[model samples]
Target: MRRGVRTEEMQEQERSKSGLLLRGRLAKELGQHDEAAKLFGEAAALEEALAQAYAAQGISEQVWRHEFSAAGCWFQAGNFLRSLELCDKLMATPDAPETLRERARSYAQTLRERRDRLWTELLQSEHTLVAA
Candidate 1:
């Protein structure tokens, strides 16, 4: 039946999503940040695709979670701008849960502070080099 096929397809997609998340976690634990970031990004894309297929089914919760995970991955990978962009996306979503929005705001602040510190350190190093 059509319903059975759709159910099976959804289950398969869920499995794939889980696998990606698990692998991304493992990569992060192992300090393979770039790989973890790539895997998380893929998982986020898959979540978006699944959302499209389901026509907004559980859209707000799922999108916020996936985006948050991807944003964390980007942060770990030192891609601050991308992480901040994802945080911004989450914050801008009208239907996002309050908890998710709070997390995004926190992450954005952390990213901004981290970026500013890195820039200052870099500028200091450059100045030292020029003076030397």
Candidate 2:
């Protein structure tokens, strides 16, 4: 009775959490950076929970998919380090689909390149400012 009620409530919470991912995407599309980041963070947490559940059930495909999604969301949220961490995890996941692993590798390379380019731009800007 009480346990059943609690389970229902928990399920409802999970459903609400899942909705954040879609909302985050919408916010991102709208260029609402702060809101998008917050929503994406919430959604990433839910994705992680889902990943754990899938792992418990021995569902490797779902686990990797959720992990990849969460990583992407973190990247969109400007959490590059976290995104890279998850990307590395995806790459290291044994028995994961080759396509997914390749995607993770590609994403990691892209992120690194983007970071390096941004760093160079920042340094160049700073040098110009110092010269002035």
Top-scoring candidate (TM-score):
2
Give TM per candidate. 0.65, 0.79
Instruction: Give stretches of model 2 more than 4 Å off.
Output: 1-14, 129-132
4-118, model 2: which lDDT tens digit per residue?
A: 1224544564686679977988898998989999998887777777777666666667778888988887887778898899999999977888899999999999998988898
Which residue pairs show backbone clashes in model 1? none
Per-residue C-alpha lDDT of model 1 across residues 1-132, encoded as one tens digit per residue: 022123567668778978988998899899898888788777766665665555445444555676787677567556788789889988988777888899899989989998999999999999999999
Deviation of model 2 at 2, angstroms? 30
Total clashes for model 1: 0
What's the CA RMSD for each of the models?
4.6, 5.2
